[model samples]
Target: MEIMQSLTDGIMLGGIYGVISIGLSLVFGVLGVVNFAQAQFLMLGMYVSWTLWKLLGIDPILGIPLTGAVVFIIGYLIEKTLIQRILKAPPVAQIFLTVGLMIFLENAVLLIYGSSFQSVVVSYQSLGFHIGSLFISAPYLMAFTAAVIVCAGLWIFLSRSWFGKAIRATSQDSDAAVLCGINVKQVYALAFSIGVALTAIGGAVILPYMTVSPSVGGQFSILMFTVVVLGGLGNVAGALVGGLVVGIIQSLSTMVFPVQLQNLILFIVFIGILAFKPEGLLKEK
Candidate 1:
């Protein structure tokens, strides 16, 4: 029963993890740039949601669209002004640029929001339901549901929309896409914007169960990377599978290992995957 409970919790947590990591995967897939600053966008989303809750009396969960929109605009501007310049630079330059962006975002948020931690006080923050002996957390369930909806929507957008098809074409071969009349630069900017927006939405959904601080993105940075790598860096569907695998590992680890060692275990899995299957559990599309 205890194991079953952990599994349930893990699934809920994994769904959110998958959503957050999908943006990272998408950015890398389309741009061929590994964005070290992606998690900061998640932090930005959390702040957006928290602010809406505090100032406008909006529920954090209810403010997800606003959070996503705000972050999406920020992402679009950043990609156009900053990332677009480095798209063809050497890998080291790209890495350094993103790392610098990550630092800037962290300190910028710190300067504005200060060092205080913030969280939302939603009505269902502490609520839960039981199915026999297995308990499900209300916040987790809501976040998971939202994550699913967002992912499904993304899949439809990517697979069906005209712009989505253009994005896909650009990802497969930018030069070829250009020859075919697709605006490759525009696709890059849109893809980067959408990628970060998805991550921010993930962050907003989890506000009920997590606190937001400037450094919170640091906590998720490594986890997000692990999920992306485990699923395959550019494989969107793989990210979801990786998230489930990671969430289950984390949940079950707490049963036998100290809470402090949870990350240690994750690090081990990450290392093992890199060593054995660096291409990831899924083949790149």
Candidate 2:
């Protein structure tokens, strides 16, 4: 029973982690920018949702569209203002830009929101249900459901939409996309915006299960990176696979290993994967 419980908890946790990784993976696969500020974007998302709820009493789920829209503008402006200039530069230069952006965004948020921990403070967030011998928290269950829906939606959009084809074209061959009368620049911005929107939605989904702090995104970001790499670089579906595997690994590790030590399972698996199958479990598109 205890083992089963840990597996369930891990799946729940991994689902939350999966949502964050999807955004990071998308941006990296398409634009090749690591976007180290992904965590900060996540923090900003949590802060926005919290403020909206506190001031106007808006439901967090209902505020999903509003959060996505706000972050969408911010992300698009970021690419237009700075990232676009250094797009042709070396990958290391791009890394520095993202690092600086991460610092600026995190410090700015800390200055404004402080280092305190915040939660949505909803009643049902702590509640759960029993399905057979398994118990599941409402927040975790909801996070899992939302994660699945968002991932599914992303797949459908990428596979079915015309804009998705344009985006795919840009990702595959930007110069070709430009020569073919497609606005590759616009595709870049649009792709990035949709990517960040996922992070915003991730923040909202995990609010009930985790505390939102100015630096919370930092912690989540690294784990998301590990998952992204484990799933293979540039593969969106791989992010889902990697996220669930890492989640289950960490959760189940608690049975024999200390709780804090569970995090190592991700990196260990990551290293093993790199050592064996460098392309990851799935080939990156």
Candidate 3:
């Protein structure tokens, strides 16, 4: 019974993970650039939601769209000013660019928001439902549900919208997309902006249950990358699956290992996946 509950909790956690990973995957899928700063945008969303809640009494869950919009603008401007310059640069240059951006953003937040941790208190924070002898946390369930909704929206936008089709075409071949009257540069910026916005939504949804600080990105960075890589860096469907697998691994590991050692197990799995399946489990052959 305990093990089953843990698995359920893990799936809940994975829902948020999947939402965040999808953004990362999309950026790579569209632009072919691995953004080390992606998690920082998650941190950014948390801060935005936290501010809105503290200042105007907005519920973090309810403020998800706003949070995503704010992050989307920031992402758009970033892609235009910084990421665009590196689109054709060496991969190493791209890595350094994003890593530098990550450090800068973290420090900028520290300067603006300080080093103190901030969390929101919601009515549902401690609420839960009892399914037979198992317990399901309300906040987790809410976050998971929100993630699913947002992911579904993303899928629809990517598959059915004109801009989304252009983005997909750009991802397939920027040159070909250009010949088809698509603005590849604009598509890159839009995709990256939307990607970060999605991640922001994940951050906003989880705010009721998680704390935020400038350094919060560090906590989830490895885990986020693990999910993306496991799902195949640019594969959206794979990210969702990887997220569930990672969440299960985390929950089940807790039954045997100490809490502090939980992430260590994840790291091992990440390394193993990279060593054996660099292309990821869901990558199309």
Candidate 4:
């Protein structure tokens, strides 16, 4: 029964994990750039939602779209101004650029919002339903449900929209896409924007359950990267699977490992995966 409960909770948590990490996969898929600052965008999303709630009384879940839109614009501008310049640069340059940006964003948020943690109260914040002996958290359930719905809509948008097709083509072969008049540069910006937007939405939905702080992004950065890598970098579908696996690992480990060691376990797994299955568990062996 304990194992069952852990599994259930893990799956619920994994849903949010998947949603937040999918953007990383998408960005790599389309732009071939690993965004080290992706977690900062998630932080930005949380702040956006928190601010909207504090000022206008809008619920975080209800403000997800708006949060996403705002983040998308910010991402677009950043891509155009900074990321684009590094697209053709060496991997070291790309990594440093994003890492630097991450530091900047973190400090900027700290300066603006202070270092204190902030959270929002919602009607369902403390609500939960019982399933036999298992208790399901309302916040987790709602966040998971919203993630699924959003992912479904995103899949449709990618498959049916012209821009989506263009993004896909660019991802496959930017040179070829350019020859086909796809405007690879524009597609790159669009893909980055969309990626960050998705992450922001995930952050917004999880706001009710999670506290927001300037440094919150530091906590999720490795976890998000782990999900993307486990799912196979640049594989959107793989992120979902990776997230579930990570969630389960995290949840079950709590039974045997100390709280401080949970991250050690994840780091060990991450190293093992890189050494043995760097292509990711979801990829064809």
Tens-digit lDDT track of model 2 for 1-285: 988898888888887778778888888778888888887888888888888888987766667778878888999999899888777899999999999998998888889888889778776776989988999988788778888888888888998999988888887888898899998778888888888888888888777667888778767765887788888877888888888888988888888888887657666877788789888787865
lDDT tens digits, residue span 1-285, model 3 = 989999998998888899988999999999999999999999999999999999999999999989999999999999999999999999999999999999999999999999999999999999998999999889999999999899899889989999989988988889999999998999999999999999888889989999999999999999999999999998988998899999989999999999899899999999999999988999943
Tell me the TM-score of each prediction against the true structure. Answer: 0.99, 0.95, 0.98, 0.97
Better of 2 and 4 by lDDT: 4
**Alpha-carbon local distance difference test for all models:** 0.93, 0.82, 0.93, 0.92
**What pairs collide in candidate 2?**
none
Off by over 4 Å in 4: none
Report the C-alpha lDDT of model 4 over 76-126, residue by residue, as the tens digit: 999999999999999999999999999999999999999999999999999
Which portions of model 3 miss their true places by more than 4 Å?
none
* Candidate 1 lDDT trough over 10 residues, lowest sum: 57-66
Alpha-carbon deviation at 32 in model 3, angstroms: 0.9
The segments of candidate 1 whose C-alpha lies over 4 angstroms from its true place after superposition are none
The residue pairs that clash in candidate 4, if any, are none
Worst 10 residues of 3 by lDDT: 276-285
Error of 3 at 143 (Å): 0.5
